[model samples]
Target: MAEEEISQISAGEFEAVSQLLSSSESLQLAFIIMILGIIGIVFGYRKFSSWVGSQKFYYKRPHFSRFVRRAVLPFFAIALITAINVHTQTGVLFGEISSIEDETISAHEQFAKILNTFNILVIGYTISHLVPIILTKREKSILEKEDFDAWFELRGFSDDSEDLFHKLYKWVPPNNAPEDIDEKEFQELLNTEKGRQYLEQFRTSKGNPIGGYEKLVDNPFEEWKKSERAKYEKYYQNCITGNNQSGRKLKPGTKPDEIFPIDVWREEKREHGYESLIPSSRPPGYAKKKREGLPKSAKQILPLGIFLATILAVVAWWGVDLIVLATATGGFSIGLGLALQETMQNYFAYIMIRKDKIFVEGDRVQLETGYNGYVHKITPRVTYIRDALNESIAVIPTRQLVNAQIVNYTKENKLVPAVVKVGVSYLNNPRQVASILVKVGKRGMREIVDTRGRHLVKQKRCPYLDKNKPSCGCDKELHVDATQPVVRFNEFNDSSLDFSMWLYVRDYGAQFKTKTDLRMIMYEEFKKYDIRIPWPIRTVYQGDEKKEFEEISELDPDRDKVIDEFGMGDIGRGEGDE
Candidate 1:
């Protein structure tokens, strides 16, 4: 597949196209066109020639002037040849074509043969014209991936260069220094160059004290997670559906304790007793109570008037041409199909949204296409989502939302279950690993709200006067079972013993932060226990010679350097330098 793509990219017009025209005259014309193309490539050398030398395909030199001369000029040249050949055959340049049959005339018949060759040349020209565009677009896509891979690999390396925490900050406190040092000793340390350096480090990057390096990699994965969390938080705050603590409001003058709570009805009963339920005013058919506008007989004839107007329109349309009628009918059918297709889909999607409770405003939802965001708004046609991954607004068609598998983080409850997976060396005891996980999980539990055993509090408190009424108890409360953090040994892979643990948190906003804390704590605990997070281990058996197995670094600086040189590194270098 790789070789085929390379071959396609390298393939070009000038030499390969000479065989497309068979006749001597047509062949000569094709040869002339090839020469012109060669001339264009030669003159545009400074613009695009550098692209040809690299072993990897050059998609295109994006200069409009160069592209026009190389890609567009050949098509024009072939078109001109075809036009002249057609004119020579029929002698109809800037004039009407002859209606008389010409196959009987020998000269006209021979001219027709030349015209056919020109047609072949024109088709060949069109193919040649399309090849560069198709190849260039595909090549550009591949190059973008290559550029991303290089950037991803270099992110940590570049961050290390900027990070002062490991290089200097960690040394500032001085190992085993006496905490009870006198003022004289403190002053002496302050006067030293190390103290000044420590102070200067604090001033760097606008008083960013620890200098762990501000997010050097613009990773989509991290951005997506952030956006998802932001969406969840927005939903958690604004959504009327789940975990709302505020109570619903009641209308004015309504009695809370009554079966029928309307104050007006109660007032009427108080004034007139049981007779209030029966109207005391004039009946519907009475002169004063009757509707004052159109006569009943005219109202009955209104439908006949509408039906006659429709019949007249049909009679007028019947007098139009059959061709016109057919065309109009076909066009209307097509237009109706196009409009109704989208409309019907949206209609069904709306039904699904309400039926399945797909999502509501402020709910964090991820589409099947991997676009996850807090639903900012749901309109008749499109659903607007505030993307969690990038903090951007994603407007998706309601129709598309119906087909997609929307993963709503806040669907079940505000608390999203989080899991941390780690693999330790096989040498470590399973029980020991489980114990460490529980310890880290407990540590992670600190400052994070545990949703387990938490219940959704009603938005409004019921009126005490109506406490015995069913309407007062209409508010539903949901309770979740209290769960302990669980650790499970999942799989024994080729390299390590994989284990996963589950933790519950109340706020989806703090989910990632909690995970990070757990991982960091686990790392420290693992180090203390002398348990290694193992790399993939492979064993190769040799027949005679004994070979030592060594772990290799994941990154190759030399390979990366070459790829970066060919990529958009120059553009990124300015930003990196800043």
Candidate 2:
């Protein structure tokens, strides 16, 4: 029986070969078509890639063009496979051909299915890459247009969506409705579908859909009350947690029970709320309200979207049951989690740092561990700080930075406070010394501020009168009452009276120069005033000086000669020389 079955299979294979030999012409034509199609696909892909690379949008985003180019090969492969299958099945390419056996047809179908699955994977991957690029481009367009409403809509806010509930059930006047329409006419117009659709685009200040009437459906000022309450809540929480977004802690002796007025909290938040990655060209107090904005949000969401799509595609194409897939996914996830625990922690910390506006690039920060520097760059895992003291880049892990105490000297204002300590003799009057210190501080402040102001005017960046002018009285405009130089009598030391001269410089970088200027000025002023800066003086009493002199004479025979040459005859005497 086995021999008979084998002989039958062999006979079937021989018959299939004979049929192929009978249609050599069709086979050659099919082979020629495939070869030409492949050649055309290759040439077309290169041209398309070049064209895409040349376009302005893709030129700016080379990665997007690369992704597009990578997708071309798989796309052409699918197209070629489809063309071959169609010509084989329909015989339209030749218009006359020998019949293909069921076995051959079945094999082709199986092969096509496998290729199609692979094509789907490639297409899905391409889509994943393109989604972020598209989103980024859209965000850039909206930003360039300065269309905040479109941005809000892209973020899925209700301000851009139609209020279905108000449109159907409520009847109120749209905020933007024609003022000419009377109550009666407006009501009549609302009965029509066109009027309703037209009015649907407008909304009341409270975010309700505007209807036929001119009045709002809800209390117009209720939203303001809710907004104020929310602000107060956040302010209260921030105060309690000491997370003021500036990375500064509350001053010592601050009353925990003291709650600032909502207005004060609102103003504070308004001042410190937004941080720009680069310096803005806008005027001061023009709050940006958004940081990296929609582009960053899209970048964050795209990764997760890609991850979920990949898992779905795997399950769909591989025909794996959900239960087995879930089990394998769980084990894989556990292993990945364990391996990337520290990395994930740092990434999340980086997110927190960015969201909270703790500190940004170019901010001068002093860590509790004595690492003081300007933040050069911030990455997912590490923050690079150019050390101010050593002029070296310090790489700190994001997780460690988030947990460490940081003093952001340039957060609220660029002006940094500098102190110059001076010690004067007790004979000098404290009031006189204080006056001299204040004069020195004021001199230093004027010199530095004038120099900086002149530089700004040269650069046409002075915020005073005419920016283009060489000097527009910027000194008066730049001066702040709070930053005026002051003198503090801090403490009394053994040698002299300690006093600190405090003044503000233009920025953290200017503080060192300002301090040096103050010290030099103070030195000259003290000398002119005859104010003595006393040094520590010690008095020593020697008992039995004659015996001490005898021991010295025994140790060195040339003691008398050295004393005669140096005129030190009084060294063994009781008289003291200081």
Candidate 3:
């Protein structure tokens, strides 16, 4: 009975197919239009794909070319569909088709509208994909033009060292579990209590319980499934699959855990120890100059924004109702805004920082919060600062930088003035002390200019020299009078006359050393001239010296007994005593 019912249903479908084939001329015309539309779609796709493939840059990236071609195919299909719909309506209007079913025309129009909507989504996706690529290309061009050769070279060294480290220290499972047990099966087993019990039986090669398995058992599954664990699991899977294997082979006697000289060197390089050792490789002020020369972040962001806006415009043109879109997004927009309030503020602050030229990378700045450092990097949300006093990095929100007071030492000029104060005895000749102070200041200035001046000139950081002609001999005048050391007897203290010697150094980083040099020079010159730096001296007098002694002796009867114990017969005798 079931077989007979199926046969009846098949017959009905076959009769329907036959009826469609023998339908009116209008139906046949619609069928022909669809077939032609499909053909046009195929032809248009081929032409578009070929054009994309012919472009030199796009041709090199076949995957990207294919993605772009696939993305654009929906638009081509929609256009052909629209054409077919237009032709069909024209036929009906002119009576070329004696009659057409309203439902049939309606279905065709609906299908075309759906394709148009799909095409809008495809366009939006294509623009989103292209924006990053455009920004990356612009950034690469900008970096290429700037002097980041040292930074790039350092990065290359780091990558190579990391590669070498991985090779030297190959990762193995905690325990040498049966090689036959698939990692995937082991992970799946972890989900079940019985499976976990089974895994707990296997011991590590070291003859100890599996540490990782123990950790898994201790922590709740949900907590263990957080992002950090997920990342570790992914990394472990990659390691097990040999995806992270470096092709380099080990030396004849090298163990997997062996530390090599190259590894040590790489570690030092990572810590910037190598850069410090080879100062000539990295020009002074390289970070500062590179930051100054970098194209503004706006240059990268503005074009991407415009491109996205154009995509939105195309979506709007495709008959997406703005009122509906706004209403649908209103709640989502409010939630997102609340969630990203701090993020938005930071981004705006980053724009302000760049626009106002408040500070750049390598500028030594002290924030109102007493965070002093050189700006290492500037991102939309966070600014990384390398501490001036140590190797630590301070991560400051960009908004903090905008809202807080900052003292930027390298904003307008690299040269910064430093003062050294000294106190001389009041009896010492003020003019002579002043002369020695000025002399030491002059000597310190010469020493700095001679030692660091050449480097500053090379870095184009010399304040006295023209940036265009760094070797114009104009800097030589700085040694004589351009920025001569100034001396002022600024204060008079109770014990001494305080004098301040003011001098200028190349930059903030040099100020400390410069001050030290000047102090050492002053010490030597002061000793040579027999100038005394005084200390507090106090002299106290009581009523009269003899009377005070007599009163103290009378007050203390033990004084005579103390003198007799020391075998002194006469105690407290004066000059007139007999």
Of the candidates shown, which would achieve the greatest lDDT relative to the real structure? 2
lDDT of 2 by residue, 1-578 (tens): 43443333322222343455345576566556766776888788878866774453342344556567767865786677666766555645435554466554443343335435545665666677666767765665444233233222222112212532332234454554455446676777578876654454433222233345332336423433343355455554554456664433333213231333333233343343211111212222233232322224547578568857875765554444555445546656788999999999998998998999999988999988788889887878788888887569888888998889899988866656777887886666566566666566555644544342432111112222222122222232233345345667879887679888776555677667667767788888777656678676643645575664454335242323333343321223365653
Q: In candidate 1, which residue ranges exceed 4 Å CA deviation?
A: 1-348, 351-356, 448-478, 507-509, 536-578
Residue 178 lDDT (model 2):
56
Residue 282 C-alpha lDDT in model 3: 29
Question: Which stretches of model 3 miss by more than 4 angstroms?
Answer: 1-318, 376-386, 391-397, 449-482, 535-578
Any idea what lDDT model 3 has?
A: 0.53
**Candidate 2 whole-model C-alpha lDDT, 0 to 1:** 0.55
Q: How do all models score by TM-score?
A: 0.30, 0.46, 0.44
Q: Write the per-residue lDDT of candidate 3 for residues 498-538, one digit (tens) a residue.
A: 98887766678877777877888889877765667876664
lDDT per residue (tens digit) for residues 1-578 in model 1: 43443334322222223232333454355446645654664555534444342211121123232344455444554655565665555554313222223334333344444445444544454444454545554664564455334333222112123432232222243333233444466556558776534432322112122223333345554443343234333322332233232332212112221111112222233333112232213222332222233123322445455555544443343342434444546655787889789877876786678678778776877778787678776665777888766668987888887767778877767656567899987666565567667666655554332243111211122221122211121022214543435677889988789988767654455467567767888898777656578766676734332211111112224323423333321222365483
* Deviation of model 1 at 246, angstroms: 31
Model 2: how far is 509 from its true place, Å? 3.9
